[model samples]
Target chain A: MAMERHERFSLPKVWKPRNVGEAWSLKRSFGSDAEYVAGGTLLRTWWEGEVAERPAHLIDIRSLPLLAGIRIAEEGGTGIGACTTLAEIRRSCGLAAEYPALPEAVLQIGAYSIRNVGTIGGNVASGIGDALPALLVYDAELLWFDGSEERIAISEWLERPEDCRRDRGKLLMQVRLPDRANAVETPTGGGNAPFSVYRKVGRREAFTPSVATVAISAGRTEDGRLERVRIAAGGGAAVPHRLYAAESLLEGKTPDPDLLPLIHEAVEETFRPKGDVFAGEEYRKRTAANLVAAELWKLSAGRQGKE
Target chain B: MIDNRTELAPAQSRLTLRVNGAACEIAAPPSTRLLQVIREFIGLTGTKRSCEIGRCGACMVLVDGEPVNACLAMAYQVQGAEITTIEGIASGTELHPVQRAFLEEGGFQCGYCTPGMVLSVKALLDRSPDPSDEEVEEALSGNLCRCTGYGGIRRAVRRAIELGR
Candidate 1:
């Protein structure tokens, strides 16, 4: 006869707040006792009864006014509410036209249902795979709210992978992208100038965690020199990081056929990509370099041809 | 030896949600997934649960006019949100435009992925009134249907766009 174990489990207590004030109050009251559930896609998995430990209370922040919608910032950037779902971001024409790369990244996230429930805040909070890399390319800043105070900036909140493991209680509140950073004022005839592109190399076409993801945003001066370039890669290291050496190399130089090899070399030196089940380290490193080169080539060609 | 003597508490919780414009409450654990609540408790079997993780789009439903996977959403999260299931697609006797398109275009055969696919299209059309082919493909990419091969589904979305216009 098999021994029977009567395992009993209780779900965490839920508190749904209708407004931002209510959400803040709950956050203050619960302190570290609660975790905010926006889309609940990630939270559900974390507490799926498989985990031995889980939060005791869930504060549903979907209805919170502070964490909703997409608004244009005064500085000519986009302010995405933490609770705004990927589906909503993809559907907005204002955002689509203004920040094409954002919608492009949003369209490729999980599936229709996951996009519906997964909020930008949840994506940033998780700091996993393609989300951070894509935002990092736009020089995005994360806004965070602890129980007592709110702070901003990408550098301030981002954990160095080691730090993320040590602590908890920091909640990502919003992500802001400056409009002028990658905005193309004059259109090259072929279409609008390609300012940014997010590339993900995965096993399958859709709904696959990226083996390696690269995001690049750059601008070309009217005088034909590279004005600014931002590059970031993830899924191969402890944490996604800016390819500073690679960006520095491309800053003043025009991307020509000869420069492509140099760009590739610079990217390879900047990060030591590691292997996982999805791909080998060699493959990820090579592809990350190739992706950055390809994006640079495309942006340069768009500006040079002006077609 | 691991100690198993920790007394676990019994489950007690009631989740009230509006399903297809009707208020229904059920006694379930707080951790119960909305997918389970819909299919098991309310007995609305239209939503399919595949990959229980949020990767597969089989368990999609519209919550407050937005399409989301039921598998990843907790039942308690739907307290005040309006949920539309696959069963709610038809209006009394008339078929929804997407449903009609799917049938006419042979959008499904095994039909396991049909509910999610149709709901996704509904959400897309609700937002875009008229979307390009690329837009349609992007919208439906989340729902996986190995049966119809997606070519037919793509055609159905095109047809629905025409009909909707």
Candidate 2:
């Protein structure tokens, strides 16, 4: 763990802490010099991109008992250890069926091998991760350990990842997804079933950061009104945020194909996502809006198929 | 602007890595990439080193029966885990079915990305005997074959599935 020789570049000293207390103490002592790494996919890429420095001490917290595997809580909600890799999450059929948006977003993150090493926690911690919008729609809760423990909603943390990362020392422990298995208590049949979509439009088919990533989930009333509508958009350097205005507009409205244009307009107006040189700001907004509008129209189609 | 290839540093720990059904002892810092560990320490150069970043799947290997980008993982991190590389895939004289499929279908031209492509296909087939087109596409999406343009690789994957069946 004490290797400090720079042959080509400075490789960080890796510390394998056994427990949360040890991990915290090491972070406390090393301060900014130390970083808690799970998958290390994001950190490694950032280093290769020369955007960030390799920390002196990388506290490997992937093996910590508190942050290890996927668990089904007593209440039936899925509690995924922050250290769990995206690939591992994808393998869980139960979890995928429970929330397709999450697994769907996982598929769009990176290819299979990258997903194998990239942890969901690392994705969430990065904030700009493509998975953020999908997690947002699910109302994912992040459990963090900072001296003590605190549970914060993903929505709150996404607002200021840098500030949260700085203040909490990047100690994200678990992501708890609420049990939505029996959540559909609406008036009737398959029409009331929640429809969710996670779409990532990238420069290429894979690997690149998304041009505009969007996730939207909604349940419809028996009388045809949309309810519990959640809309989120993100990609590239843009901060992932909820489209509350678009959500409200879509809410209490029937899933008519004619409403697609208005919903699209509302999303385009609300999603103020940043864009890089490859894609302009307007393109990302429109792409996200189009994806959301198009995907939601499936509900209208689904209604027809049911009737 | 610092030169890193000047002087060597002291090796950190002697790790017993279980690679390809054999025990190989490697001594390096905790931060050494699995790519270096496999190539330099384990002496297996079959795993190509293109982009040191995890973007290119040239350095893919199976860790405990699951495919992962070797460049992204630290050697010490997977010390005890069972690591399988391209060199280990063949049964001595005979090549693995994935490798055979690549040859039969002309999966590669320059052959730089062949090892990784083969290993990725093997991983997929091992997990799923019958994978859908989407699954195959997703599994191979990380690997970049600049020469073959993936047409041959696609055929190779299909052929490999047939071979497995």
Top-DockQ structure, candidate number = 2
Candidate 1: the clashing residue pairs are A77-A179, A189-A307, A190-A307
| Predicted model with the maximum lDDT | 2
Report the Cα lDDT for residue A82, model 2. 88
Overall lDDT per candidate, in order of appearance: 0.73, 0.82
Across A5-98, the per-residue lDDT of candidate 2 in tens digits comes to 3323677777777777677767776788878888888888877776776788888888799898989877768899988999888887766667
Clashing residue pairs, backbone N/CA/C < 3 A, model 2:
A7-B4
DockQ of 2: 0.38
What would the per-residue lDDT of candidate 2 be over residues B25-121, giving only the tens digit for each residue?
7777678888878887778899989887878899899999888889889866786789999989888899899999999999989999989888888
Query: Distance from true position, residue A41, model 2, in Å?
Result: 1.0
TM-score of 2: 0.92
- What are the clash counts of all predictions, listed in order? 3, 1
Instruction: State the lDDT at A2 in candidate 1.
Output: 8
> Cα lDDT for residue A48, model 1?
49
* Model 2 residue B130 CA deviation in Å: 2.6
